[model samples]
Target: MALTGAASAPPRLAPGGVVTRADALLAALRAAAPDPARLPRDAGALLGERAALAGLRRNGRIAAGGRARLLCAADGWIAVQLARPDDVALLPAWLEVDPARFEGDPWPALAAAVRDRAAVPLVARARWMGLPAAAAGGGSAEGGAPGMDAKPPLAEARRAGDAPPSAAEARPADGAPPRVEAPPALRVTQAGTPRRRHAGPWRVLDLSSLWAGPLATHLLAGLGARVAKVESTARPDGARRGPAAFFDLLQAGKESVALDFRAPAGREQLRRLVAWADLVVESARPRALAQLGLDAEALLAEHPGLSWLSITGYGRPEPGGGWVAFGDDAAVAGGLVARDDDGAPLFCGDAIADPLAGLHAAWAALGALRAGGGRLLDVSLAGVAAEAAAGGVDPRACVVADAGGARVLCAGRSARVAEPRARRPAGRARDLGADTTALLREARA
Candidate 1:
């Protein structure tokens, strides 16, 4: 929501929580819908339809700038002109959310929501629904809705085709505030400028697949670290062939190398990389890394200062029975996702939970690397989901309007998946706090 420096991070929801953009867009669409309560039960399905509706309304007036028209709806749904019927047909899947979680200080509550939601997985059903601004309306060429664009200044930073401006150009002259395009998919900053070489034993091996693991390495690469992205031909990263925007966006500023770790040579290459690397990031489930014979303990044995970052759908085993299964995005919605009582999931509409955790993992790796300890990070998507929702999944907390013409309310201001009061027996109390006590007593009487 606030931008201080030249680089402004996008809003991030707790690991399983909705990205701010997704929330903003969904809220706008809900507010504008003929009947806000008629959205679909599934968040993904509703978003698909809403995007389709926006396309139909525009009717081919779609332009590089037309995306801004969508954001303007945040103030109130307004008429959006499309350039062509095809443009209108294209539905936006990306939903904007609160930016503070991503750029500013990390909110533990949001992070927890992301963790809890990782148990349920969802397919990447749509491309990022970008709302580029309309130039004619005094909006920059950056991809943002009129007033509610993701990062209006960041949108202004790019020249064309989504490339970031040169480092020199990124900084504004005359002491004026720097103008940026949408928050960059890749933010590359060396620890120090070229003239001042950064101090360290530096090497990072990225043995990760999908957006989470690889994205972490990509962030490091942008920051002047040489990242070796190792993917086996047998188990390639899914994003290698994802949407054009995503693939280009995710893979930028990095080197791509393939290796089949199952093979003897692959294992040898991996070891060599590990021996040379200061850090390694993997997205496989717990102990899955050991199958590849890349256990954290063994890695530390080989490289005393190796930072092993492991990302999983769920948390590492704890004393309690908190073990849960999580998928990419869908799981988060199913678990911690905001929904209405009628049973409609409020889709965050972005691959938010996974990536935010990845970013945090990168930060953790950096921290461990700085501390000079061979660190082991278990990034739990489910934990992140729970953190996002502030430690609970209450269906009555907020009303989410969807495309299918439905509205779902999560009960109470706070609801914990670990203990759902709504499921308790009538005239009985589960975990009702003081506020809920009176209501429960009144209902019982």
Candidate 2:
């Protein structure tokens, strides 16, 4: 289903039509699954899982989750996500304010600081400092125009040693002279015969935290994959501090193995766990894992039948690989925000990018596995949001005002703009490290 048009005020779900898109992808996934019943029936509903638990709502300049805000800059609006304490701590530095004077909440000071600054420089500075920030409507540090068409690809994949085509080497689809260089959206890093050998459920080693990665693996688990989630003993998933039901919904069926990455024995156990899986899912920056001596390329090379799914904010490409992002800001970077009556940007859903990326990542991982593993699937939150926005609003879709607020009418079917709902957890999620000892003992055996 498409979002309502511009002639009237679009409902809160207008901008990305992400729920509709996710529903389509989910349907395709179920069609390809060995057991269609294993997958969830409503992809659109999954997008609102977190909101359902957190009780979030759509606020024009403020994100539904209330952690990110769209503040005005001298040139345009920019989204700054203070989702973490570290992000809040960096505010004084980001705004060039005196730490001694900065007190209480940072939003007022932040809003005042950026009121006279240009968005491009502010965004560039925030990214350099590792803050999750982005210009409204897809503007970047490179000065790209703010529009849906100018947004970067939802995700780009590349093999080792691959580079963007030179202008001279590129060609337009219309058979005209090459105007600009562009990198391929996806490329097979390695080819292998399709591994139709499904003697048992696929084993998945999940080394991701929070929403995107965990949600992907959770979906895989729902499809009968045996998933083992690995978390650091010192730093368990931050989600544990949030709503219990939300955390349980994403982690219900997985075995938890907490390891101390700083210790040699722990790292060894991690390597063994990696060896034990047919697929590995992670969301760390490209270099973060390499620093831990767990490189994707090296692991893929060693395990020719392994499939690795890497979820990131931007992607693994050079400059973007170094940037930090969260769901709200990343959605802004992807041009996925709804437009207000004055054409200003508004946060559409509750950290919408996370679920969108999660769904896409799960789908991509399954495809790679079906193709016989030996591949790295790089899925980015911003990239997926951009792709969703690229589909544009469906002209046939319209919003009908009703006594209960608003309902979206599309293709002769109407759905109410209701509160997001959570799914029943398949089972209780195991405590952190609950399976570490047993799994490690089995690995040794």
Q: Which number leads on lDDT?
A: 2
Deviation in angstroms for 391 in model 2? 3.7
Predicted structure 1, TM vs. truth: 0.44
lDDT of 1 by residue, 1-445 (tens): 1000011122111212343423443344344344544321222322222223222121111111122121111111111222223333432221123444334322232233222221101011111121111111111212111221233223233322343232123122342211211111222222221121125535677777655676566556545566556667576665554443444444554545566667987676666666666777776654556667776656665556566777765444321012222222212322333222222222232333454555556666656665664566667654444344333332233323344422334433432211001111112111112222332232234
- State the lDDT of candidate 2 residue by residue for 139-195, as single tens digits: 222122245432232223332234433222211233211111121223345633344
Best by TM-score: 2
TM-score (C-alpha) between model 2 and the true structure: 0.85
Q: Estimate each model's TM-score.
A: 0.44, 0.85
Error of 1 at 232 (Å): 0.7
Give me the runs in candidate 1 sitting further than 4 Å from their true place: 1-201, 318-334, 341-344, 391-445
